[model samples]
Target: MRLAIIGGLAAGPAAAAEAKRRAPDAEVVLFEQGPHISVGTCEIPYLLGGHLEPETTLQVLTPEAMERTRGVTVHVRHRVTALDPRRSRLTVEALDYGSTREEAFDRFILATGARARRLGVEGEDAAGVFTVRDLVDTHAIQRWLDTQPVRHVVIVGGGYIGLEMAEAMRSRGLRASILDPNGRVLGSTVACEASDLMDRAVAEAGVPVRAERATEILAEDDGRVRAVRTDRGELIGCQMVIVSVGVEPRTELAAAAGLRLGDMGGVAVDDQMHTSARSVWACGDVVQIPRAPDGRRVLWPLATMARRTARVAARNAAGSASTRSADRFRPFAGAVGVRAFGVEVGSVGLSLSRALDAGFDAVATDVRHVSRTRAFPEAAPIDVRLVSERGSGRILGGQLVGREGAALRANVLVPLVIGGGTVRDLAEDFDLIYNPPLGPAVDPLKVAASQAMRDAG
Candidate 1:
């Protein structure tokens, strides 16, 4: 069997390796359009802040290592221009040599992932404007910082990337400001109270965050960005602009090949990661999977989801009998984690608003407590909010915010939500490791769950 995988960032490599492992004699080939493969894109902000070296982001896996260890042919700077499902052939372009070739495969996997969404406003093509997406973009940002006199940066979004880059710019002694069109930071994902807390944390770091949208980008004679014009008619001066609005799935190849797409504009795949086309599979950010909380098919561009879905696709491609079972694939619960300033935040399943929107009679309960025992000198404040169905007390969702132990605590709630455990079940059956220096005797999660149960009652 011969397998051809497109897009070698996160899912493509995983699929290639897994396919090789499951079927040792099968020929596996991974193609990447960039010079590097498997870049840790989440760490780009830290590289910009000087906290991490540029080489660290490229350390996830090298193409040579994949070839040497996994017996997979890794082709960097090779772009798949067209897919011929009927012929089982791909029209690929060798970017470095400017050559074109055709590759035949018994099976194909589409892991093209996503590209950064752009604002179509005027002057967006200015020299100093950037979108944080790939290794090339990070290198370009680093070059700008090294060559140009950039003392201030304007981030045009209030999402996770925008907030993280704001913190990164501040660490590098640059004045960072966030301009979000939405009235609140983090938009509707986070509750109002938690959003306010995050906003205050960013503000305290000397990064001014505005709830105004950018009408236009102002550029100088050299076509370098100078400032941003807001919808409120205010000009915010800056030397650089980082646009982090969001990302859209890169499904041009899939759509052109006539693959069915989901409501979320991603390639539609079944539980086995099988696309509508025969002998082809799709995974990563380009495919929409079932979100567990409400069973809705949504686009979740998380690394965890990407890796899991890719492995499933690989197993099916390799003709694994276990993968043939309908129950082999697990649903994604949309688990996520983020850190800004000194606070770490995490959420799993749904938010309070999402639970209500899903037609559940939900009640959210918030609890505040110290991460450690009060007697412990290093104890820090931790806040937990749990959303539960009113009558059944089922744990629909949860959010955590704190200087420490936030993500760890939120991870505990993920299984509960996936298993459909109730708040009362968490209160009665949950066991958390504890010590004076680590955490309180009664876990904060249990406390929050108990409170949720009461609210449900």
Candidate 2:
């Protein structure tokens, strides 16, 4: 049972490790184009903030470690240029030196991850402009900081990566500014109120956010990027720029292999993470699955998703008798914790507008209260909005904004969502722990539910 995994990052390595564990004698090989595998994308900003050492986060697993510990052949600096699913083979190009070869596998797992999206704007290729998506990007930008007189930085995009990078650069004593084309910061992921709160938090950190602004990078006379031109005709000079627009799935290999591609531009996979082609599977950012809220297929890229996908894909790849099931994989439960920036904002399930768009007669209730016991020292005001079906009172979605610890409180809604608990169920439910210092007399969940009950009437 020979298995070849195209990527050695998050999902690929997980699948390889799992497959080896499932079938101890199985021949498993993991190929990575870069020097490292299993690197943490979330910690890139922390590395920039000097919170972590470069080696601590960059190389997740060395080839020597993977080979010796996992008994798996790990190939670094190798590219799988082409795949021949019909022939059960793949063409590999060794990047270390001049070498081309073909690898045959009884089973194949395509875990190729997504890359950072580039705007392709003028001066984008300049030395000062960078994207913080991978370890190399982090190293490159950090190296530039050593050589360049980086006093000011302009961050393009207001998404998760953008916000994290903004904080990282600012904490390092660089004057950071974010230019977002959206009307509000993090508008694509968070709702209006949460976005505004985050914006305020960023402002408090001395980071200015330019909203609804498009940027055009202008090169200086010395062929270096000097300033970014905006739609408002403002040319802001900055010594460095970090562009973190978003990510797109790398599905060219999947598409060429005649596998179905989803509307979200990811490879289509079944519940088991198996592709349309037999003996082949796909996972990670390159595979789009169904979102629970709307039953629509979309790419919800996250480390959690990568890990789960790896387990499912590996089971099928190893031909395990106890195959994995879809129930093991749940729609992503994600939130953007704004508490790190001073305030707390948490969102889950879906939004009111999205619920309505999905054909639900939804009504939402907004409540304000303290996040902790009233007598607690640092009890901050908590503002929450919960959306429920107008008549049925089915819990659809929720958002929380408040002081620290508010994000963790919002996580209580996850089980309710997964269990299909409604406003009525929450109103009558009695299932939670309470400590005076950690919570109020009445849990915020019940308080919000009771408030929603009133609004439902």
Candidate 3:
């Protein structure tokens, strides 16, 4: 089998490695436009915090290492400019030499991740202005920091990435502040209470919050950032600026090749990660995923989705395309949005608003529980909120917020949410762990679930 994988960060390399393992004799080639493949993107903020070295995180696996250990050929500094799915061929550009080549494959996977969203405001392209989406962005920020006299950093958005950069800035003894367009800067995926908790956490870190949008970035004469003017007519002065507004899928190459895109603006793919084109499957941030049960499209641009979908796509691509079997087609298990931010938050499935948008008779119930039993002096409070269908009591979604156990609680909800477990099942069916240092006798998740059941009744 001759398999080609386009992209590298998380999905591309994952599919390539899996394809090589699934078909040992397969000619697997992975192409990455960036200099590094399998880069540690989540650690970019920490790299700014001076907690990690660039080489340690920037390059998770070198092209040489991918060829040596994984038995796969890697092409870094190369971009896939065009794809001819009809011919099962792709046009690749050697970035270093400005040369082009044609590559033929039996099957291909598009793991082309996401790109940083721009503010669309003036002076956004100035020096010392950046977005922390990839290793290249981080390196650019580092280079600017080495030359610029930075004391304060103004973050344009108050999302998870903004919160992380706030911590990173404070760690480096630099002042940081966030400017969000609304009070619920954390976005709708987080419950109102969870947003409040995160707000408090960011405030505690000495980062100021402003409910405004950046209208213009005021830069110095040398094209370096100096200040940002908001729509509110207020100017936020800072030596550096990091725009953490969010990201959109990089699917132009896929779309130009006649691949279908979902309403969610990502490349559309079936359960087997097959795109509309023959012999071409898509995965990673480039594809829109349907949330479990409700089947509503949710933006799951996280690493988990990339890895999971890539494995499925690779397994399918490894088999003979002509002898396709239904039994051999591995279905993509839906995602329960899992993320760890500055406050250790994990929200699975859907939020209450999302449930209503999905046309569910939903009710959200929340409770305050301790991280540990009362006997433990170090026990901290954990906020648990669960959303369930009002009529059938099916678990819809959940959000956990606290200094500890939030991500752990989210893990427990992952299975329940994915398996379509009900509120009653969470309340009465299984026995959860009971170590005083770990959790309460009845887990906080169950406590919230029980409340949800009662509220549904």
TM-score of each: 0.97, 0.94, 0.94
Q: Give the per-residue Cα lDDT of candidate 2 at 327.
A: 28
Query: How many pairs collide in each candidate, listed in order?
Result: 0, 0, 0
Q: What ranges in model 2 sit over 4 Å off?
A: 53-55, 192-195, 320-328, 335-339
Instruction: Rate residue 15 of model 3 by lDDT.
Output: 90
Q: lDDT of all predictions, in order shown?
A: 0.87, 0.79, 0.82
Which residue ranges in model 1 land beyond 4 Å of their true spot? 54-57, 188-195, 320-323
Question: What's the lDDT for residue 436 in model 2?
Answer: 75
Q: Look at candidate 1 and tell me the lDDT of residue 350.
A: 86
Model 3 spans > 4 angstroms off: 53-55, 189-195, 321-342
Candidate maximizing TM-score: 1
User: What does the lDDT come to for candidate 1?
Assistant: 0.87
Residue 404 shift from truth in candidate 1, angstroms: 1.7
Residue 388, candidate 3: alpha-carbon lDDT: 88
Clashing pairs in 1: none
Which lDDT tens digits does candidate 3 get at residues 270-332? Answer: 877888998898888998777775776555788888888888788888866553444122322
